[model samples]
Target: MTKLTRTLALSIFALAAGTAGAMPRPMDAGRVIMSDTADRDVAIDTSTRWVNVTNGQTVRFDVGGQRFTFVFDAWPSTDSVPLSAIAPKGVTVPDVRVYIAPNPLYQD
Candidate 1:
């Protein structure tokens, strides 16, 4: 191939690759609630939400007027509490467990 044609083809390929890499992925939608170290009760009427609880933090969720408290068992690491954790206690929603974590299958 000629020098100019080769340069144009390479530029197009680079642009296409960059565009593909920049494409956005579908993300799950939910409310994120962060708690402090002190133990306290939080009222959450919403059916869907994610709670990030730190070590020594106890969060009580009042779902649908019923109270359900979950204490962080692991120390020194924050725990990702999905809606299912509180569902068995009192929270009403579709019976499903959704655990969100770093995608191990992801590639840079």
Candidate 2:
């Protein structure tokens, strides 16, 4: 191939790769609320619209007019561990979990 053709092809390839690796712009505030209240490490992946937390990383959130806390326990198999929360009675919790595909969301 000619040098010009090769350069154009390389440029296109690089642009495509960059676009593929680019992360989506998160439309919401996303963060991992880590609470070390025990010997656990929780990593809450809320960008996916679910509170998928890991061991020990607990996310504290406020729903309605009350506050709620989600805790992830360490147990068998450590792949994609889920999290749970304790909510007060008669309160509606919003879906605070947000998953911006292509990459994990972050807050500034």
Candidate 3:
């Protein structure tokens, strides 16, 4: 194989292997909620739409230029929550579902 071709193959292999970690799914506001799964397509980018949180922990994520913090008071929930539950009184977040950590499959 040519040197450039071999390097390109290796780079592609490395990129695929590195992104095998679980990624959260995205949902539009007012849309029906679907079961959360890590085996989603690579094309969908939900990086900013979700937040991973731990038991009794607080997680903060940004949408646009604003920051929002969510305290997992109701941790151990099997479902996601709306931004209104965590957002400040007047700031309106986008139509997205926020999920906490402990993705179940990773739990004991």
Output the number of the lDDT-best candidate. Answer: 3
List where candidate 2 sits over 4 angstroms from the true fold: 1-48, 74-85, 94-108
For model 3, the stretches where C-alpha displacement exceeds 4 angstroms are 1-47, 75-78, 102-108
Return the TM-score for candidate 3, rounded to 2 decimals: 0.39
Best by TM-score: 3
lDDT per model, in order? 0.47, 0.41, 0.48
Residue-pair clashes per candidate, as listed? 0, 12, 1
lDDT (Cα, tens digit) per residue for candidate 3, span 43-67: 1123445544443444554455555
lDDT of the structure predicted as candidate 1: 0.47
State the displacement of the C-alpha of residue 99, model 1, in Å, after optimal TM-score superposition: 10
CA lDDT of 87 in candidate 1?
42
Runs in model 1 lying further than 4 Å from the true structure: 1-38, 75-78, 93-108
Pick by lDDT: 2 or 3, better one: 3
